[model samples]
Target: MKATIERATLLKSLGHVQSVVERRNTIPILSNVLIDASADGTIRLMATDLDLQIVENVQAQVEVAGATTVSAHTLFDIARKLPEGSQVRIEAADGKMLVQAGRARFNLQTLPRDDFPVIAEGPLPTSFELPATALVQIIDKTRFAISTEETRYYLNGIFLHVAEDPAPVLKAAATDGHRLARVTVARPDGAEGMPDIIIPRKCIAELRKLLDEVDGSVHIDLSPSKIRFDLGNAVLTSKLIDGTFPDYSRVIPTGNDKLLKIDPRSFEEGVDRVATIATEKTRAVKMAVEKDKITLSVTSPENGTAAEEVPGDYSSAPIEIGFNARYLLDILGQIEGDSVEVHLADAAAPTLIREGEKATALYVLMPMRV
Candidate 1:
């Protein structure tokens, strides 16, 4: 196929789709991207790893109506290094694909289009449309908790399901063995029959990137085994995990009443400073709250102790808790307020966190042994 596309635009699109393509492949065509050109000023790009797939459509000035397959990474690299805003011409030759822009010419290896694996688009049983911001919020809240353990394969993905808590709501949750993160939102009308799908971490990351550019909404496609997202120019499809996620609803605390409101910046900074002396294996920061102050301290057998006292709005009975410094930082990164609310019952109980705005976002962290 002969097609003329702007180098920058084509490069960006290739970079997005090519990310899913694995480098060393048993199947030769798996590293190549399918390019189809039509006389109607449109060119489409598609790539897959068999388990996951992405299809993108670009507006190109087409000269000939045909299709071909070329190396996705090589083409992307060549276009990106070219002079800024140069027009790129791609044409299929006898045995290779030719890439030309101004003074630079690249002959990239190609594979037969027939060898490319194409995942048939399944008829989605349940479909819904939601704002990109909402999807981003759920992912941002729960993705950090996703387990990295390959053995407990079910916990390696974010669980998206409808649960009856705080109402019949849409929720996402993930956890390794140490900590758990769960977030719930009121389900929309179209989500009535939304099947519970476990979305892999890689899918969440790619979807997050695409959602960044979306202004308003996104279409969600789901089957029991797969999930698909349709944006304006791009489409993402991922294979869902077949196993079941752990029952995490019972893990979140409901009776923790004592609350400590401390400056998020101060609390975060104190933990950071103290954790510097903490051992790498533990990374524990201890918190002791008094009348109007919260003290963060850390001690290591080899290294001396480090401590910092920060002024807070703590009135509840004094509470001392131990937590991983890294987990505290992750929670603080998502909170957007001057003061952070820490809900506690005792040292052994899970600590609930909020940044004054309860409806906005809430975080719960398990206490670590000091």
Candidate 2:
């Protein structure tokens, strides 16, 4: 294939498609990206790692209509280092791909395009569109809580489903046994009766890259086995995890009676200060709440003790609870508003946290024994 593409355009598309290519591959072609040049003035780039596939189209001047595969990362690096505003000319000759830009030239080995695996596309029965910003919000709120444990593979992804309680809404939730994050937004059109699916962690991460740059709508198509996202000229398809996600609604605390309202920034700072004395292994911090004040303290036999009191609006009986400092900070970081509402039942019960008065997003953190 032969084509001339703008350096900036090629670099951006390469940056998106190359990430799906794994660094090491059992199959040589798996580490390469398929480049197809058509007479229609566009070049199609595709890369896959068996589970996830990304396809992007870039505007180019096609001199010859053909296809070939080349190392994804190497091509990306070459494009990135090329001179600004230079035109990149690529051509395949005698099983090698030549990349030329200004004074720099590179000859990369190529694999037959036929050897590259293409993910099969089937009829996607359910399709809907949602604003990219809203989707990013859901992912940012819940992604941190996804479990990294391989044994319980079901908890390794965020669960996406429709919620129909007080009103119809789309909800995303994730949990790692120690903590849980749940976020809801108004359901998009054509999302009703959509089947619940567990999107793999890697898919969520790669999709986030695209969502961060685009302000347009994202078209979502899902079936029983796979999910696809179309954002402008780029398309991403991923296999759905086979395991069923646990019912996350059961883990969210409902009867936590003690309520504590405090400034999110102040609480986060207090926890950070007291956590300095915590042991590196456990990193546990204890919270003592009484009246209108809450004290965050950590005690380590080897590091001594540290405590900080933060003023809050709390009227419940005195309660003490231990929690992982890292987990507390993660939940606190997600709070967007100044005021944070924390609901607690006792020292051992799970505590619920919310941002301001909005029920759109909530966090549940399990207590750690000090």
Report lDDT (CA) for all predictions: 0.85, 0.92
Please provide TM-scores, in order, for all candidate models, with all chains considered together: 0.95, 0.98
Model 2, residue 353: distance off in Å is 0.6
Q: What stretches of model 1 exceed 4 Å from their correct place? A: none
**Candidate 2 per-residue C-alpha lDDT over 165-222 given as tens digits, one digit per residue, 9 for 90 to 100:** 6799989999999999998999888888988899999999999998877777999999
Task: Please write out the lDDT profile of model 1 over residues 266-311, one tens digit for every residue.
Answer: 7787888888988888899999988888889998999999989999
10 residues in a row with least lDDT, candidate 2 = 355-364
Which has the greatest TM-score?
A: 2
Clashing pairs in 2: none
